[model samples]
Target: MDLFNSAQGKNISFVRPAYFIIGGFIGMAHVKFYFVFLFFVYVVSVLGNTIVMLVIYLDHNLRTPKYIAVFNLAFVDLFGNSALVPKILDTFLFNHHSISYNDCLTYMFFCYTCLSMQALNLVALAYDRLVAILFPLHYMVKVTHRFMLTMICSFWAFIIIAVLIAVGLITRLSFCKSVLINSYFCDHGQVYRLACNDYFPNDMVSYMYPVFIFWLPLAFILISYLYICGTLAKVATVQEGLKAFKTCIGHLSLVAIYFIPLLIVFTLMEKIHPNARIINLSLTSIFPPMLNPIIYVLQTQEIKESVKRLLKMDRKLQLKRIAIM
Candidate 1:
């Protein structure tokens, strides 16, 4: 790592943490397979999420404040998947295992920042649905465009500050030697473990910070769901209850895919094999982005109809251009 120049103009070389070793199971064949599989994942995820965001943008009917939260969630998935999967493809397919210290930090910052933002977006989505169903009369007043914009802005600002603080603490530590990070990407947990100084404070901040940052939003989502469920149970008809449940299915599936494997890895982090841990991380990171739009298209009739209508219009426009030519 290049820290600074001395008064004597000597380029002082710091003990720069060099290449991080990304864990993979088995031989060269596995690398090729991973490359193909993950490339497909990245392409499909980006395309799907882009379509979701575009439909929400183009359609006047879907311009409610709740869809604003939904659009932000799509943006989060696009951002996170873009940050992570291409690097994995490079690492596996081209044997580019080495990531610079600066690149690693950039990767970690975006990954965590997006993850934090996604959690908050889900929390907002849950609250939106809760308001719509539980108190339909006040839903418009409670979840206004102004309110959604404020929440989205606040979430991004908070994650930026939190990541900057953590990275600031990381920069203060002295690394005595080139350290090998045990994962594919420069995860804060993987990188911070390489510091030579007193790691107690870093560990404390790392472990304690997430409970409030991640779990608090998660808890709010859970409470919102609980109230939604309880309120549905009291509805006069089973069809009404089912209709209410249908509204939440997309968000519920997204939360399940995003968090369940992550919870499993968190529970078994210390005990799992390095390859297993890497696999879990990759799946949890990549799967949600890939599945999110699919979930909405499948579960939400409005989005499905909107997508079909858009595609039909696109086909018609293409034919008209062909006729003119």
Candidate 2:
């Protein structure tokens, strides 16, 4: 927080965020508003995910394997946003692609790597559903708490490997010729465009790895969920099906909202649709952090009731403390 508040850091952040708030994402008018918005997201996302963790930790009934998986998902989103959003905000709000070479490399690699953790998280969640529905008894033993820890560790380690591979490839090349980057932030794909030396390996890793690692996992998860959906269709009891449907709906909504805009924005970047960039960025960066908490509140009965009761209890406690004073 102190870093962001520093006069220098604050100055650097001002140049990056115009892609969304003022609707000139490509025009590069004011990155300051964008960083302000990102700071807001960081606080809210951290708090929102923490609330989910607290609600689950406080409530014994929420200790089921399913909600446990949800806790992991929340954790992933929290850290993922933390890693990427703030740095991007700084690039604009601070400098016009003015990041120190080392800082840019570190920031870009780690941010994307952290975001890749989400790929594995969703896959893990999908498998959780598959086992729960098709083989409940086995799901318990297979998706045990220890097993969850292993998944988390392995996923992060692999993410590091991917980052190293991409960055190692890029840093080996030269970029002294044309330092000015066109993108609002320094995505390596856009960075490659500006590099003066050969970037064939960088290009290959950039082009292929996102597909092999992130997209492949996402596709598998979608396929698994499709089968899960079909199985859900066969539930003999309407009440049982509705219960399952409600739980999954919140996550599915998040996936759609996150993925669609990303596909359109990144895919169409070369085509140069400023409106799409603005819309896509707002949906991708802003909504998920702020609105996802609302998703959990509406979807999970335990959380909704807990929040309501928490609010009531807090009010009473305040009033009683006031009377005594």
Candidate 3:
């Protein structure tokens, strides 16, 4: 393969490989058991998220701005898990480790886009809570259906474009060296680092992507909650403050579930074993999708009631059908 790309007029060569070997749980002890657990998680995630979305769709009471963010979160979770877990099973469990270069980039695009949106969706939920508690009187006006939809759509658009740019940068890289990806999937960092040519652009993106996806969204959520706390403190009674805080329990649980594991894993990356790091990263990615809907269903009264109402309506419909028959 040619080492230099004379077409660039910079003596840089592009040696793109046909396929990259994914080092997913290879040589790991009892890894199949983990994959089985991941399969169970994926199945529950699909069912739970689908049910959440269905409830929000069917229940007119849930057709509010708040549920818009809820619905979006469920969708993002479902999409994110679908993009990740299935591919992991196929690649590692089935021993189909060699993925085409373009396919790898495509995989990274979907996984990262959904992951980014998951964090931003939490930000949307936090914004909803912030407006609800801090400006209760004007909550409806501030968090209208149109406004919520626009916010979620804008997030989707921005994340899609940002992830696309990241994937595009990988095309410029020449992976003349080892094409073995150390992580589970076609991780952007692991893939780009294998490039024989300069990957400065990819490296810059690696740092910036986390800030946008993790740090900024987390900072926004924290600041919003701080403002919420300040507002609640001014309320006339302790009970009133507690009630307002109660509304945030579901969102808080979600925020913690989604962000805490990621923060811990990244902070402790250097000290952890590579296999352990990969497992933690994989868990952090898959667990949130499975847990998000469960948290909302259990911690959020509104969703719980919606689910109950949906079940009752379905039961009534079935009884009426039997009566007619």
Candidate 4:
């Protein structure tokens, strides 16, 4: 009460309690084990994405179009995880579940922005591969560094505008209920459901924006693959066709890993309990970033060889150290 009053005196438009209690799997069984599992996922997501960025930075051969998209995806994942996972850890480990109304909005904005950027990055990746497999001879000319830079800049601009619009709309709605957000992080859906004013516009944007941001990119990816498959079918030899198709194997795996859980979770959202919903949401959010680097590391021969070479150098350095000692 004191905190809320003081904040109100200072012109802060906060909920009476001044914080929203995040329903981060409250009353779930074996919560410690859940914390341990989520902690491991957080570590893997951060470390794996870091390694992806570092590997792409250190290897000159990976400075091309496809790896550039991969690098951008890793970067977005790292930022998104940084924004979301720490709050989750705090909630589970330290019982700090109260988030201020303003902070909640900020977090939601960043999460959506990263999500939008990731979808755009996937589209860029699909286009990159489409050009490579469909027009191998002109891939370099068509997908130049300058072109990629322009695309990246344009994407950031578009997402910033979109996020600002959504946030602006959300901030206008009034909330007078108990400030309890029924999710791990501040989901926009959960937050806006507490609004006391007209919320139909917010609902419309919430549901419709996803179609443009998520489904459109998905459609583009499918079309790109269709063209890629057609082109591969026309290749001279079976081995050549296989080689071309193999290049997309990692991407296909990544897309499946990222999207399938989300689809299932969305489909079953109403059927599941709140705790189950939080667990499902948290897993679907974190797992893709954690496994993305692993998929690339395992599936791409170039990255595997790079890792092996790095290991060999470490071994040679160890031998030199022993000799010196």
Give the Cα error of residue 244 in candidate 3, in Å.
1.0
lDDT of 4 by residue, 1-325 (tens): 4333232355645433466778767778888787788788889989999988988888787888778788899999889888877778888678888878678779888988886787788788788889888888998899998888788878889988888888888766667766778788888888778876678988988898878787788888989999888877876478998988898898888888777777788778789887887888788787788888889898989888877777787899999999999
The parts of candidate 2 lying over 4 Å away from their true place are 1-26, 29-40, 58-64, 94-97, 235-239, 266-270, 274-283, 305-325
Model 4 residue 73 distance off true place after TM-score fit, in angstroms:
1.2
What local lDDT score does residue 220 receive in model 2, on the 0 to 100 scale?
A: 82
lDDT of 2: 0.66
TM-score of 2: 0.77
| Worst 10-residue lDDT window, candidate 3 | 1-10
What tens digits encode model 2's per-residue C-alpha lDDT throughout 181-261?
544454676666555557788888887877866578879878978887787788637787777766677667767766666
Candidate that scores best on lDDT: 3
lDDT of 3 by residue, 8-59 (tens): 4456565778888999599999999999999999999999999999999999
Please name the candidate that would achieve the greatest TM-score relative to the true structure: 3
TM-score per candidate, chains pooled: 0.89, 0.77, 0.95, 0.90
Error of 4 at 109 (Å): 2.1
Q: Please give the CA lDDT of all the candidate structures.
A: 0.80, 0.66, 0.91, 0.81
Candidate number that wins on TM-score, 1 or 2: 1
Sort the predicted structures by TM-score, highest score first. 3, 4, 1, 2
Q: Pick the winner on TM-score between candidates 2 and 4.
A: 4
Candidate 4 at 40: error in angstroms? Answer: 0.6
